[model samples]
Target chain A: MIALYTALITGAIMAGLQAASAAPPGGEFPSKVPVPADNPMTPRKIHLGKQLYFDPRLSLSGDVSCDTCHNVAGNGSDGLPLSFGVLGRVDRPRHAPTVFNSAFNTVQFWDGRAKSLEDQAKGPLLNPIEMGMPSSGAIVKRLAGIPGYRREFARVFGGKTPITFEHVVQAIATYERTLVTPDSPYDRYLKGDKNALDKSAKQGMHEVSDLGCASCHAGAMFDNPGLPMGTGWFRKFPMIPTNPTCATYVREYHLADDPGRFDVTHKQSDEHVFKVPSLRNVAVLAPYFQNGSVGSLRTAVRVMAACQLGKTLTGLQTTNIVAFLNSLTGKFPVETMPHLPETPDSTSMMQVAKLQQNQRQLN
Target chain B: MIALYTALITGAIMAGLQAASAAPPGGEFPSKVPVPADNPMTPRKIHLGKQLYFDPRLSLSGDVSCDTCHNVAGNGSDGLPLSFGVLGRVDRPRHAPTVFNSAFNTVQFWDGRAKSLEDQAKGPLLNPIEMGMPSSGAIVKRLAGIPGYRREFARVFGGKTPITFEHVVQAIATYERTLVTPDSPYDRYLKGDKNALDKSAKQGMHEVSDLGCASCHAGAMFDNPGLPMGTGWFRKFPMIPTNPTCATYVREYHLADDPGRFDVTHKQSDEHVFKVPSLRNVAVLAPYFQNGSVGSLRTAVRVMAACQLGKTLTGLQTTNIVAFLNSLTGKFPVETMPHLPETPDSTSMMQVAKLQQNQRQLN
Candidate 1:
């Protein structure tokens, strides 16, 4: 009887620990992301990807690079309503979403246009309105011309074509996967840190679960890349059977207009439903929603409530939800970008050239 | 006699070892600066100084500050025939001298008018043509209003009351003195570092002593504050006794016209002579004469040779001398200026009302 009682007590204690640590229904996320077989994650690829992400020379203007939009200093997104790209000061059509925990998305892009980060990476580089490199060939030639880059490319890519668009995309994707949002107050509170989150955040999180936001955004990686042991393939996130919120999209499954995954797959059932975004550091990233219709977090919650739960949240409840969203923010590494060489063939060069020109004019 | 020979051999070997370990004569400097006493270096302060140095807040029209002409990043002097101050484009009459070793000077300003750095600090703040604050009292009142500055000022210079002009000057002076040059190749060579300098720098340094440049520019803190142990109390620098090549002024005991020392004493014999400027980093500091009549190091050397030595430097010799001047470019401690509050209600408010007004209009 004593041994049996001890066993029962130990089981109860383990359950209690689980209750404390498990994401309070809403904050639960996937454990891992699905990676394509061709471009496997490697240390070399990650290193190269990090370098490419920071190199401003990748852009045609050499100024409005990826860093201009997704500033590491300002929690991924540049805290702007929409990004300013290439030569134009005019705002972009969509908000620059945070790349903090994007790896586990069932599909990338607000429209669910791309299947993987590798697929997503290629879209931006070729989006003439973005980096505005004339052509991939031109970019390759330019990179090849830089002797340091030529040597580095050879070392990283294992004698593969040093200047291919595919290699570039693969490297960038590898780097993106490494950018996981680590332990936040939400995670810590789950992991026995009772005081990690305040009353407001905890209350907001409970509301988030009640509203069924966790149905689509679930587990460690947030979005469902699909059932781990069952099917390895990518599907529209928030599997309909599991999430009642997904039922709304089921009626419009047959509709042909930008049928989210159906466009990529041609399957009638895979329609309209898109990957849910991670809420990590979501408080700081402004201009919410796929079309950036919602500017404030409170408004975003209300819209989601109306769309997903078919219920309107009170103003105080919305404020609490926003506070919870803020609690999900993760600590970021504070490393600086490498001191890249100041090329004489650029701004300083032009200044020097102008001086020379003025001298000629004087003579 | 045997012991003396052994000592000489050991000294020679140590000197050789030092020369082998030394760094190259001159190159680019490190991005960050070191801090010193009465002023602990911090990123916030340095950032503030960088902004202030670049900012026109100190000017009447918000178009000029200390950095308007004396560009700190560009070897602490503007590369111009003469520096501009009041008006954005108006060039000031005299060549803005390099501020590299100004901290070590016994007296400051072109005429040796200021006794100490503390005395020299407020001159530009209220100089109608320079920073142009109305009065010392106005500046203090302005600073007293800024809330952010109040805390910083209290911490940096004790409680706010009697936070007079002296604190302002002292803080700035403290910041300036810490701008000591880093270990140069020569310094390393002295310390027994091999390969610290190249063959050219070594050959050039030998020529530096031969050309009599060291007469005025002497010791680690180059410009002689006053060689009390050597010559009389004070002597005009770069001007040797009995130099017939001096075309502008003649001196029996002292130059009669400029009367460098006489300006203070009204002694006609002490006229037309100025304290010699330091030649450390002279290669980078252009517009080299007191009046900035000479533009380059080579030109300055030639002018000095003709005037002081009654000998004209050959083209190669002038090049060699400039190379030697290049050798003197030592490592300087780069410090970040602590951020003092700029707001009117802050503890350490800077007196920049006109600048604030201009900024508001721009915004």
Candidate 2:
């Protein structure tokens, strides 16, 4: 079974590689994002997923949702250096990546631990420091208990028993896949509209390739595609050891302690090796970098140049890059908050009882 | 100045009283909610307030916003018995009241501590257990520092300097006044639509007046107009001392310790007295009552009947009342999440520095 699963994944990666090769120069992003074969995107699934994304009942405290960290209003990021989770837990070690156009990425997370969006959706629910659901079983039980959710799951999946953890993650992933942001100024420029980008942004686009940023940020998503899906193309951050910019970030933001992918791989070479984040909508989504150390995009550009390329960019060069990055800000879809279904008496009555019991203990 | 302010307030109250008496039988809710003369609702102010309402930067933790608790999607309540506040503080003593139709209330808070929505808005910002901002000065400074907010405040207030605490509360209150839910089945019935309510609901509506429920729940907003605006019409909860339902609630939910209005007034008669809540959208906004002890609408009906009227209602009577309460579910305006303005580096860079300093101290 493991071998068969491996073969299927390998086949998918090969197909993705072929598609990558056919991509236009500077990597013209596809207008429509691809959906996984196992979980086909449907209106019912997407609707259900959207409700789930905004619903905080998935958390133990009932105060955090997927939208809590990746707010749909602000470029799919919380605009915090580190995100606050359930019950105002603010010690998150890494920055939340933008959910916009995240479907184009090979892997999810700064360390690329989760292979797919479906897989990534499950991590936060069970993570003690995140949404703080006791278990997958607990989440399933909670959803099953809520009559609205049970009905939604049944309608979406179309089965006698469809309220499962797998369906929950699948639906959420399907909704996320539809969050692809296209038609940015950069994208329009690639589509033969020369005037789409301003003069400064055009110059910065050329500088992007000239400065070897395209070597890694190569695809339509400005994401590395050489690596297989669910696998990361890890690059050692702060490659120039003597760079003052790197030293300052390490000292101030406490970035040196986090071993990046080495936490996942447990290998020396993987130390300081972090996943290359997509630069889509990077302008509005601040503070920058994995640790959220850099507050300003201009400063971030200078630091990236110094640490990654071992070159100090001129003030004009940094300004132009910042302008080009701003051009990547695409039109966000008008997302009205979904009216969540209420928990029925059978479920909520028990919840109230439990809540009372907890309250009593505290008092 | 105090006499002038008093005269102005008295005039407004008299006008409100006249309006209340002019309402038709069954108390038909007005189409347009009354706007306070001092803080007349303006499009620009409402727009700015909407952005601020959704922005988490107002909170000390940058997590909890007004929308976090009073979510527009779910009857303007979090659907939790007690709301979780900053840093997962779940010890909130009372249920979060629905923001919908709140403009109708004579006073704000269960204890009637705040006279207006403007006054109420200020309480949570500085409440150590709520949004947990250090001070109103801190919030003002934060808003003034943000270029977007500064520009918006200027535009809205039509002044060079507009980002004041008074303006902030005024804007928020103005936005909240617009949240009045009208045009329910009950309102339609009041407007001479004979067939608006079904037989059971019709019976319940008749019982509402016959059983003396309308004595407290009077006027177009189904609020007691005898009590002046921002003044409490305090009623002792669980009026029947020997009721089993009251005993169970007091024991289980710890309702006895709250001391409702007594906490504010510190008077013997005020003990256990609470501001009578509006029944608008009551069916959907559950678990019911201020303590949130009763989960089911039917159960709530029974408890209220026994506690307030000193009558143990039959199952049929309770069911009918529940049906009638369901008729109060009004048409909710489609509220799309407003696009919050981003804080420029001139503002956020300083915030980040402070955040890092705090984090360093914690570490």
- Model 2 has fnat of 0.27
Global lDDT of model 1: 0.53
Q: List fnat per candidate, in order.
A: 0.00, 0.27
lDDT of 2 by residue, B170-213 (tens): 88887887787778997777655868899898778767767777
Cα deviation in Å at residue A222, candidate 1?
A: 3.2
Number of clashes in every candidate structure? 53, 3
Consecutive 10-residue window with the lowest summed lDDT within model 1 chain A: A1-10
Question: Quick one: best lDDT, which candidate?
Answer: 2
TM-score of chain A of 2: 0.88
Task: Please give, for residues A1-363, the per-residue lDDT of candidate 1 as tens digits.
Answer: 001112112223433456754336433332344456677788877777766775645765443345445654345554433444443222233456766666655557765677667777776665666666778886676567545566667877866587687788778788777766667787677556879889888888777767777666554544442333212233343233223433443232211133555655577776655546766667656556443334456656765675566666788899788878888876665433332222211221122222222322422
